[model samples]
Target: MHSFESDTTPNRQEKEHPGLKLALELGPLLVFFFANLRGEWLVSKFPVLATLGGPLLVATGLFMAATVISLIVSKIVFKHLPVMPFVSGIVVVIFGGLSIWLQDETFIKMKPTIVNTLFGVTLLIGLMFGKSLLGYVFNAAFQLTPEGWQKLTLRWGLFFLFLAVLNEVVWRNFSDATWVNFKVWGTMPITIAFTLAQMPLIMKHSIEQDTSGKP
Candidate 1:
């Protein structure tokens, strides 16, 4: 006997467990990272994923598969997609498919550089336009004072630009294997360090839990 009146809040069921969301997002990156490291073994097992016969190709295929799986998991478990992952997934598919079909790793290697730089420039440009676009992008994560949002958005915009530059430098100067390593493991640790350093910033601007941007 289902009631006509809804028991759940509008557009809200159970909140997604944050840890779960993080795992879904990070899992595919790990697969790509590890596959690149032990690419011979992975390609041996799933040869079709490596028709192009390059380590980078194998890693890109795994990354694309993992992105799809992550999105499906999020949709099923959280009942909706998160913004950042959705954006990333779209980029991965487009870039990954291009890399596969072109049989060139450059397309995949350039994905992060393009995505990060675009985000950075777009955020900063939006600010110049008197819009806190970061607010729109991360509204689900935190609510901040007007001043706080401005400062945080500025810092994040710069950070993204730095990441873009670093990616370009690494991929340009290093071999494909080394570049892949940096993309996953190296960038992750750096991001963790930066996130930890942002605790103070988060505290300063934080509102109530309901307003903290976690669903």
Candidate 2:
């Protein structure tokens, strides 16, 4: 559970609350999904919610708010920003603003697809160059054997691509509200399950502690 509070520095580190970390990451997403689902009722009860116009708009605003809340909580409780979430927050703010000002929900929806696809492409490309970018992202959190990193990196790269394809399918076919729900709830469960399913490989391939005591 302490992984939530874990320090992200290369030199200094702290324990984190894993459950709390997952909660913070997923909580805002659920908010956006539900908000989109019941957007009409929300707008009716609180007219302010309607200022954003329809479900997509409401979801965007809620998404932004939830992102901020998650960031603040992570800062206060964990005392540092989680690397991935920090990067994601920046993207959300930029894309969310574009969605609002442009009055196009497509921009916000594209956020995930773009981000995921970029990650996918970046990892695959990096691999071609014989570089392991996932090492940079998760090295601080978990110490894995070299083989472990390679396997994990490959899996994540493919997963990101899968998400991109899934996003395209969802948004292209479904309504805005449905797409938002899918983006949040749908992605979370799939990602977590995917992550958990990797535990065996991670455990099996993980590095033994370095004699020098550094990963």
Candidate 3:
């Protein structure tokens, strides 16, 4: 009997704690949602927040703070900041700062569109160079062949573009409250479903089983 370890397998020190990872990623967005819902009360309680403007603006400021904190925590607890979340955090700070400074909610609203489009473009460009950047982000959980990584990266790249377009549509046509709700609820479920839908491909090209019999 023999067991094989993948070159891409996460080291013991780098093994991800899924629960913590989810909390770190979603916690800031949750804070943003709740802040929007209780903006008035928050403004009354914290006089400083008033300077930022109405509820949405206040939420944007708080969202930016929470995003920074999440990244810090990820660095401390996980030993390294995740690539995608770190990129997202940078955009959040930039757009969130603009929203607060100029008192324009549109900047913050466009944050998702910008982040998703950035990811989409980066992934597609990486593919053109024969690099599967998605593997770096997801290799901890599973290893895939070169072709598998290429396919998965292409799908995710396109999916991010779709999400960017969807964000533009929702924010442009819907109420602020509705847009916030969709950000928290709608995107998460859709991403989960997309990830689940990729299971067949994942299983088909899993490199772990292929290398298991090696001496």
Candidate of highest TM-score: 3
Candidate 2, lDDT over the whole model: 0.80
Model 3 deviation from the true structure expressed as Cα RMSD, one decimal place: 5.0
RMSD for each model, in Å, please?
Answer: 6.0, 4.1, 5.0
Give the per-residue lDDT digits (tens) of candidate 1, residues 125-211. Answer: 988988877776555566777777888788888999999999999999999888987988899798789878877987898776564
List the candidate 3 regions with Cα displacement exceeding 4 Å.
Answer: 1-19, 209-215
Q: Write the per-residue lDDT of candidate 3 for residues 23-48, one digit (tens) a residue.
A: 88899999999999999999999999
Off by over 4 Å in 1: 1-19, 137-141, 205-215
lDDT for 161 (candidate 3): 99
Would you give me the overall lDDT of model 3? 0.88
Which 10 successive residues of model 2 have the least lDDT summed?
5-14
Range of the 10 consecutive residues with the lowest summed lDDT in candidate 1: 1-10
TM for every model, in the order presented, reads 0.82, 0.81, 0.88
Better of 2 and 3 by lDDT: 3
Q: Please, what is the whole-model Cα lDDT of each candidate in the order they appear?
A: 0.79, 0.80, 0.88
Model 3 scores worst on lDDT over the 10 consecutive residues at 1-10
